[model samples]
Target: MNTTYRKVIDRITAQTLALTEKNREKLSACLERFEWAKNDLLLREGQVCKYIWFVDQGMIRLFYNKRGKDLTEHFAYEGGIFLSLESFFRQIPSRLIIEALEPTVVYGLGYEKLHGLMETEPEIEHFYCKILENCLILSQQKADACRFETAGERYHRLLQEHPEVVKRAPLIHIASHLGMSPETLSRVRAGLL
Candidate 1:
């Protein structure tokens, strides 16, 4: 990891300073990169998720299928974290589906290896705990935003928070993340401009 990622690691864990040099070395060694094409299903519903991913580039969505409709629950872009959380955590089938929105490169760690690392490295454990906490917070925020925010408000907030995504992702994927139809998102954007 570079100084930048080291800083990210530190920010993710308040008690990270106690991690031994050997533990840090292990973390570096476990990091591995994988790539997938647009529309690739990284983990399908009812499948066991194998890896917890950190996005380096491109985009992914976590969604669930219900009555033949896809309900988008989360989106991960560059510098974001992603995984089928329930499957990754509980070692069971996941209801959520993880798919790439564009060609993506992700740094991934297997569940077993991550658990072992967490047991041996307090910092790694704390880091994961923080990750889970942040994920929960974000999930709640997304739910609230979609339920209560106007389309324009949601779009503007997204532009402010993830400007890079506005440039990199297709408009339809952004629409899905915003909990709007593509046409509705277009109208909202036009109205804002």
Candidate 2:
């Protein structure tokens, strides 16, 4: 396996339940590397998300269109995973669009292959379940932040927690993710400074 793929596997093994070497080899075989340029769309609205993508480099944004405006829902950077979880699990069309914000390298596991691995290896199944749980927790946290936190508070929390986002992502995208206008985010940043 290449270094990028190795890095992705290492990250997965570290984050999820420990996997035996045999299982790790099997899982690594299922990963396929892909490269995307900035502005490339991995999954568009209404399309089924076919792969669970592990970012070995660069960044991705998950967004949706509403009233002709693109609203960012989440971001995945190096060492992160990006996928339409509901669409991938349920085999339904996704309402979100996933796009690369920078030249990106990813290792993807096809949905069918993932299911096969889960069925054949108990450890893989456990790992998959843990990933699902984490995804759920993240979703809930985002929802809570939107509901209870002020825009400035949300921006500050994001800076503290995901500083890569503020550093790497465009200001406009950061504003959208924080549920604030560009001007508002600028004011918040000014206040912080």
Give per-residue CA lDDT, model 2, range 41-121, as digits (tens). Answer: 989999998888888889999999999989999999987877898999898999999999999988898899989998878
Candidate 2 lDDT (Cα, 0 to 1): 0.88
Clashing pairs in 2: none
lDDT for each residue of candidate 1 in 53-129, tens digit (9 for 90 to 100): 77877898898987987877778886788787778889899999988989987877678888998886777887678
Best by TM-score: 2
Model 1 residue 80 CA deviation in Å: 1.0
- Using lDDT, give the best candidate's number: 2
Instruction: Report, for every candidate in turn, its global Cα lDDT versus the true structure.
Output: 0.78, 0.88
User: RMSD, model 2, all Cα superposed?
Assistant: 1.6
TM-score of each: 0.83, 0.95
